[model samples]
Target: MKFAPSVGVKFHEDGSVRRFPGNTFICHVDPSLDLINELAWAQEQLKAMKCGFKFSYLPIESMHMTVFEGVCDQIRLAEKWTSNLALDVPLSETTDYFAKAVSNLGAHQGFEMVYDYVHNCQIGGSAIRIKPANEETKQALAHCREELRKATGISMPDFDDYHFHITLSYRVIELEEHEKAELKATTDRIAERISQSFGILKHRAVEFCTFDDMFEFKPMLTLA
Candidate 1:
């Protein structure tokens, strides 16, 4: 029998995950053929890892790079939620309010990003990191995020250190020491392969999407 942590907070050993309610702007990968190809390859590599730890993989079509995080039910702080809306406002209603709030912003200039790397999340998951392709792209994305901050009146605690990534899977159980090493080696290899294969992922627009869990994100509006 395997010995691993049984905390089971975000994900259960049986693979069921808790709901992570929120809405945010994301660069969905479905539109970019280049990204979609790289994504499929990366997913395959991750799934092929033979480490004993179980992983709950997300659907490929739902994969995306989050630009700016939005409100969540767990964090009810005023800074994390819109100022005008009540703290208890339903996530669906909050999503609607945010959609209209950002609808008027002029066409957001598109930007390009490149694969950075894949790493295990401190909490319990792994994601493929990404960054702007160039300085101009970085500046453009920063400007758009700033505009969103001003419009929504919600500022994340880690706004300064926000990491742009597309989540791949959540861990169903904590890994043993040897399994941790194995997982790291597997992720590093996948990162190297993806970096060599794909150059740039073209994002035409940012989509405002709401999510009930880590698996699916339903787009409510396209902010191009």
Candidate 2:
């Protein structure tokens, strides 16, 4: 459950989730170079197959490893939520401690790990899935999500029931007859080398962002 081939997010279902004002704010890590190169290569392959429009490739900078999304806005509600959810700690002091502890976890200590194995699989009706090396990465990611859930009271599906994908591109259309044939041919061509490895995730800071402001990773904390 920590990582599965699919999470059944049901993005196409009409009432799966509401379109709230602004975007879902979540903490995330900046996309690593491995991701960028993999995306660039994927885009190249997709274009070579003459199916560029079938999928929307993520611009390199837009890629991120989501920690958790759809949480309360950091600026407006973080203080209240953290205060109420702080485990065994005073409301006033818990938030500060939480920030530093997470920020400091990186390659130096070992928690800032790498996704060395990668592959492609279809997910949530989308074509061409890109995922991490294994479940260790997914488990680590889920641990982060669980901690955030504990502090914010944000709801999440069971960790075992979650789908962990690492790519930023998503298929925008269903394959037509010819498209399916070409896609299958293309998949076969890339099948041998589809697996890739992204390097260690050395996060500089966690960001809370809305859809309106997708270009910037707005820092949710003031380290100074």
Candidate 3:
């Protein structure tokens, strides 16, 4: 079995998370029990796949949809990082600085996110795709992101083509053609069940969080 070289970019062969520190604004999935339970169930099913692929499932408590990405140690480009702050600024300091900079941005009145599909990222990960449920929700989400970009002074690379998603896991090994077929079949079933049962994910507050790795996001402050 040949492993994908890209898998080693973010994780060890044993599936341990590499150190990738950063901060961001996210809508956490933990506050809603129904949402959490549904996601946890889907995650378990993905873990149970017998196909010969290896991936690391993140802690359910850490599940979230990022509202606006913040500075990261790994990505030091001007387009992705905030201007006026050194690229080597401590993650904690950047988190603090952003908290105050956008403190007056006001709270989101909550929005409904409709299930889209399950996405298999080419870079070796799987995520549940989602979108705003209506035009109001759509505008709200976009406005928030735009406001954050202006307030934080960080221009996103994919600003125009950003897609909302809640990540499930990072693949640890490459999947063969046959394995991809099997994985897609299982994920399709899971996505169908989730869309039917819990189609709309009600996102309440936006949060500013710092993270030392992919598995955990430490909430520093709530934007809403």
Candidate 4:
């Protein structure tokens, strides 16, 4: 809480190892943003390199950013999934504290996320890295993490700073030497095209959602 937070205080650069939570609850990106088209450019690069490799490209509808993921309780979630019918309360105790933290934020502000780079060196393959451009956007997510830690008494496992990114595709097959060079060239061009463009989508809410569901995953709670 003492230091400034734009992306994450732990600031792990690409290729560095950082501890990840054992479990995660994610925050979905609003579907109507213009920035998603940037993925199209990134995908095209994958296509160019697909000559000797296999890849998995994400559909436009499935993009989302994880707010915070870790341990939480399910007593309320089981109830929400059955009793509320439409609304939900997450099972995560951290989510409960985070939901309350968002309410006390005093103002509702969405963040502007700028491209850090489009790299294919991730554990999952390729991704578009992002950084929060303004204080509100940075603090909004940072504050939520702070609140969850302070209020819930849960220790964070991802202690080293983290980078924020959207998965572009996963490499299903290994690449040959020439193919790797070609892919790198493609990535360079795609990165240039998006360097100055901000994502069209604005974060609408801090949502609590179930993992691995198609586009419209079951949202346990949405704080707008």
lDDT leader: 3
Question: Compared with the true structure, what per-residue lDDT tens digits does model 3 show for residues 1-224?
Answer: 55555445556777788888888898888555587888888888888888624878889988999888888877778788898588877767778889899899999658788888889887767888899999999999889999998889898889878999999888888887887887898789888888887667888689888888888998888876
lDDT of 4 by residue, 1-224 (tens): 12112112111232122232222435556655666666666676676665423554556676766655544232224322322122243444344554554454443336567778877773346777888877778887687666544543444446337677777665544566676787778778878888867544456665555433222345655555
lDDT of all the models against the reference? 0.78, 0.44, 0.82, 0.54
Q: lDDT tens digits, residues 1-224, model 1?
A: 43224234444557665666788888788644866777777777777878633777878888888888898876688877887689988888888888989999877756888878886986667888888999999999889999998888778778878888888877776677787887888888878887787678777688988887767888888886
Order of all candidates by lDDT, from best down to worst?
3, 1, 4, 2
Cα misplacement distance, residue 129 of candidate 3 (Å): 0.6
- Lowest lDDT 10-residue stretch of candidate 3: 1-10
lDDT of 4: 0.54
72-163 in candidate 2: lDDT tens per residue?
33234543334444434443343344554445343211124454333334442222333434577556565666655554554544434644
Stretches of candidate 1 off by over 4 Å are 1-10
Q: Residue 14 CA error for candidate 1 (Å)? A: 1.7
- Worst 10-residue lDDT window for candidate 1 reads 1-10
Q: Pairing residues by index, what is the TM-score of model 2?
A: 0.53
